[model samples]
Target chain A: MIKLKEALVIAEAALKMARIRQLNPMSVAVLDARGCLVAFQMEDGSSLLREDIAKAKGLSALALGMGTRALVGRAKHHPAFFVGLSALSKGNMIPVPGGVLIRSPLDAAIVGAVGVSGDLPDHDEACAIAGIEATTYSWDAGADPS
Target chain B: MIKLKEALVIAEAALKMARIRQLNPMSVAVLDARGCLVAFQMEDGSSLLREDIAKAKGLSALALGMGTRALVGRAKHHPAFFVGLSALSKGNMIPVPGGVLIRSPLDAAIVGAVGVSGDLPDHDEACAIAGIEATTYSWDAGADPS
Candidate 1:
């Protein structure tokens, strides 16, 4: 279980990194494995839909058991499947780079995930990694290890 | 227009009130008059459904142009109408307290609405009121102003 304290920590760290990197104002969402929202924050000046995008990214990571980054290629190769999945998930499956899966360092168990928005996709993904790295938990951004 | 800064302040104030009153962990959502999410936070211990409930309450108030408190009686009297409204809104019209409309003190024009969940309905409404009162803006909890 991803405790609330850790989720808050992850969210705060992500926001802090965004500031330090001079990225655009951002929205971040942390969700437990069941895709339940644990904590969320949207920075001032962020566009209205940023919150929904952030949550959708996180939900996509959880639903597919992979970071949204990995889903991007699959989505491109199988547009029909991606479209069906999006509909099935009620538009929560956003295959993008900012969604990252959180895992336990000890056994690599899925714990939770983080989604970020308001910056370039690479920058958003970087912020997510920075937040996860601030703790003992491991993260997968869905890039191939090799 | 409800600035994101004010929205964040309202959400934080509501959460602080919930803690002070020893209410259950709560989720708070702030929405602009357009019913777009501006700021939201779900306390760690809150149930998974609390965020949805919070947003729905705020949307309900905005959709009906009244606080959710005022809708309860009307909903009870016109169950079919309320049901249809809920369906039309994609299940966002929850006719209950805790959804308070935020108004500008100058002209009483609605700026936005705040919704809180995870406690007794009355307590939730109180927290929403406290949050709105913390700002210069006014609020309507849908009670008759007799």
Candidate 2:
């Protein structure tokens, strides 16, 4: 398992790459292939809760093997489903911004994911997107990490 | 900062007090005085995602300054409102079952939270309830940690 250091490096670089210096302090979490946390980091001044948000976002993306953004539309069609999952998981099935599927060049398996918070959805998503770009994973071939 | 160890102790004690001995592997998460992770424990054979789920629940409760149950009503009234939040936080908000705000004494300023996931919602809730009963804290009546 590649440690989350790679993802955190990407997340931090994305913060700078996205010019997020003026944004609210942020938090980012990375999960392993098994969906366990590989690494978690909170930027200075971030809301303490930013962490939970990040992890939930990442898990949502990972479990469904889809970007949380797309999950929103699915939830729209099946509100109860996501709602039920939200309850089942106790509320971490957010289908929103700031989550991305990570993949690797070798075999193109999804390495993990990155979830971001402490800013607007768009900005938060922007950081995550930037984070992906910082990784070695090929974003063009998006697929679930098995 | 009360380690998640204390929180885990509470969680396990809660389960024992409730007499739940492995309906499913359970995950427990505790946050600190500053709302960071005190500790996170996922029982073996639990869902691969249990630890994240558990911690994320606790994180949601503390971040929102409400119980996971309260979010259920909020989610009902404004399902659409949470969509954006899901995006912003990146999908880590559970509003039901076995999630709580870990707080200080007296005014109950939130110090942290505990999230439990594994069994039925009621059973999970029982674990969290047991944890709180066993955990103790000290705070100046009117003081806020933040």
Candidate 3:
């Protein structure tokens, strides 16, 4: 279970990384394995939709048991399935790169997921990874390092 | 318009109030007038559904143009209408006392709403009001002072 303290730590670290990178204002959401929000923060300048997008990315990762980065290609190849999935989830599944799966470091057991939005998708994913790295947990963005 | 900074202030103050009062761990959600989330936080031990309940309370206030305290009576009298409204909102509207309408101090215009959950309904409502009081804005729980 992802404790609320750990979730807040991940969210704070992600926002701090965004600031260091001088990225656009961002919103970050952390969700436990059940796709329930644990901690969420939206920067002052974030657009209204950023909150929903951030949470949706996290939900997508949790629902699919894979980082949203992997879903991008699958979504492109199977548009109907993706669309139906989004509707079924009440628009909570967004297939994008910023959603990352959190895993227990010792056994690689899935714990939760984090999602970030506002910057480019890749940059958002990087921030999410940076946030998870600050903790003892591990993160998967679903793409082998190239 | 409610800034993210203000939203966080409301959430943090609400949680702090809950702790000071020795109430149960709580979840807080702040939503702009359009019913979009601005900030949210769930205490470490909060149940998974707390986040949804908190946000739904705020959405209920925003959608009905009144604090949820007022809606409770109306809902009891008009169960079918309340039920339909909840379905129309896709389960976001929850008529209960923990939801409070936030008003701009200057003009009394509704700026947003705040919701708190995890304790007795009256205690939850009190925390929401306390959080709003910490800001320059005003709050309405839909009941006149006795």
Candidate 4:
């Protein structure tokens, strides 16, 4: 499992990079293996809903054991099951981009995930990837380094 | 309902106590009466499971109209029904200690609940109780304190 301090630093770095890149102010959340939040932060100008969106995205990634972007494809193919998942998690599971699974650098084990929100879907995803890369962990994109 | 700022302060204090006492790192959650998260934090070394455990416990307390510890006795007598609730809430119902409802100090209306995990069950409960006491909100034991 990733340390909480590491998780927070990873999340903060993601937000800072978003600012430097001129992306919309964003909120980020990191969740541990069991879908528990490790750390979370919302930039001052982010939307009120950013926190919930970030958390749900991260929870979906953790619970499903894949990046949430992958779930988006699956969700489109199996809309009914996807909708069912939302109800099953009491409205906490969000199948969308911007949630990326983090793998250990040494052994490639699943450590946790990071979720970003408050920008376009692609932009949000970029921020999440950037955040994971800032840490020792790597983003699990099923083979894509970027 | 408890405001978001109050909820954050309560969760932080609970976590600070966990650190000062040299207990296991803990994750804490505060939810509104409608079961939406208001604020959350996890200590530096808490496990990944702590996040889910804390949120489920808080949601259980909010939905059941009592503390999670009280629900434990009921769960024992109605194991089947209790298990069914997990399906009903999409696995968000955890009938365990460390989930406590918060009531408004003046009107005694339900405000929210706090959930803590990453320590002994009784110790987790103590941290949760300490958090609520730190706030203006009072712990609701299903009685009229007003």
* Estimated TM-score for each candidate: 0.90, 0.52, 0.91, 0.66
Question: Which sections of candidate 1 miss by over 4 Å?
Answer: A144-146, B144-146
lDDT (Cα, tens digit) per residue for candidate 1, span B1-146: 88867987898899899999999998888888878777777887677699899999999999989999998888888899999998999999998899999999999999999999999989999999999988999999997332
Off by over 4 Å in 4: A10-27, A33-36, A41-56, A59-97, A100-111, A126-146, B44-48, B76-87, B141-146
Tell me which of candidates 2 and 4 scores higher on DockQ: 4
Model 4 reaches what TM-score against the true structure? Answer: 0.66
Please report the TM-score between candidate 3 and the true structure: 0.91
> Quick one: best TM-score, which candidate?
3
**Residue B47 in candidate 2, Cα distance off native in Å:** 37
Best by DockQ: 3
Give the per-residue lDDT digits (tens) of candidate 1, residues A1-146.
67767877888899899999999989888888878877777776788689889999999899989998998889888899999999999999998799999999999999999999999988999988988888899999997332
Please rank every candidate by TM-score, starting with the best.
3, 1, 4, 2
lDDT string, candidate 2, A26-99, tens digits: 77777766678877777764545677778887877787777777675567677778767776665677766677
Local distance difference test, candidate 1: 0.88
Instruction: Locate the minimum summed-lDDT window of 10 residues in model 2 chain A.
Output: A137-146
For model 2, state the Cα shift of residue B138 in Å: 24
Error of 1 at A124 (Å): 1.7
Alpha carbon lDDT of residue A22, candidate 1? Answer: 93
Query: Which of the two candidates, 2 or 4, achieves a greater TM-score against the reference?
Result: 4
